[model samples]
Target: MQHYQVKSVDTKHFRLTQADTEIGELEYDSWFSFTAEIMLADRTRYAIQPKGFWGTTIEIKD
Candidate 1:
């Protein structure tokens, strides 16, 4: 399993880090919408859209 650290930047944004290195960001769009920008260890970047009553599912976007 991989461990992630989330630090809140503000009410609408947060920073995602792993092993003390920043990997991405999570931003809230509304009550039930948000976006994630993640950078993998391989150096590939991905944009993810999470949606649901609690934002439990994600869809990858390019």
Candidate 2:
């Protein structure tokens, strides 16, 4: 199974890592809203945005 680890980069930024390798970053617009920028192992970059309150779901497109 593959698991992701999230660590605090500061008050507004967080880092996402898997197997000790950096996979992406989650940056908050405030204390609430955020955008996630992720890079796959294939080097494909994706930008994910939250659609609702508390980020109930994420929006991603190809």
Candidate 3:
């Protein structure tokens, strides 16, 4: 298994790191809606948002 670390930059921003290198970034779209955009180190982009009931699930799109 591989492990990734999440470091919080602020209330709405976070960094995903492996070892000491950053692999991706997550930034919230809004406070009310749990939506975000993810940008990878390789320049790949994705959209992430809460889905299903009570926001228990999340959906990721490339």
Predicted structure with the largest TM-score when compared to the true one: 3
For 1-61, candidate 3 gives per-residue lDDT tens digits of: 8889999998889999998899999999866668999999999999998999899689999
Cα lDDT tens digits, model 1, 1-62, are 99989998887677888899987776666445566565555567778787777778888876
After the best TM-score superposition of candidate 1, give how far the Cα of residue 51 lies from its true spot, in angstroms. Answer: 5.8
Candidate order by decreasing TM-score: 3, 2, 1
Q: How good is model 1 by TM-score?
A: 0.52
Task: Write the residue-wise lDDT of candidate 2 on 1-62 in tens digits.
Answer: 88999899888778789999987776665665556565555667677787876777889744
- C-alpha TM-score for every candidate: 0.52, 0.56, 0.84
The global C-alpha lDDT for each of the candidates, from Candidate 1 onward, is 0.74, 0.73, 0.91
RMSD values, in order shown: 3.9, 3.2, 1.4
Q: What residue runs in model 1 are displaced by over 4 Å at the alpha carbon? A: 31-58
Q: Which ten residues in a row have the lowest lDDT in candidate 1?
A: 30-39
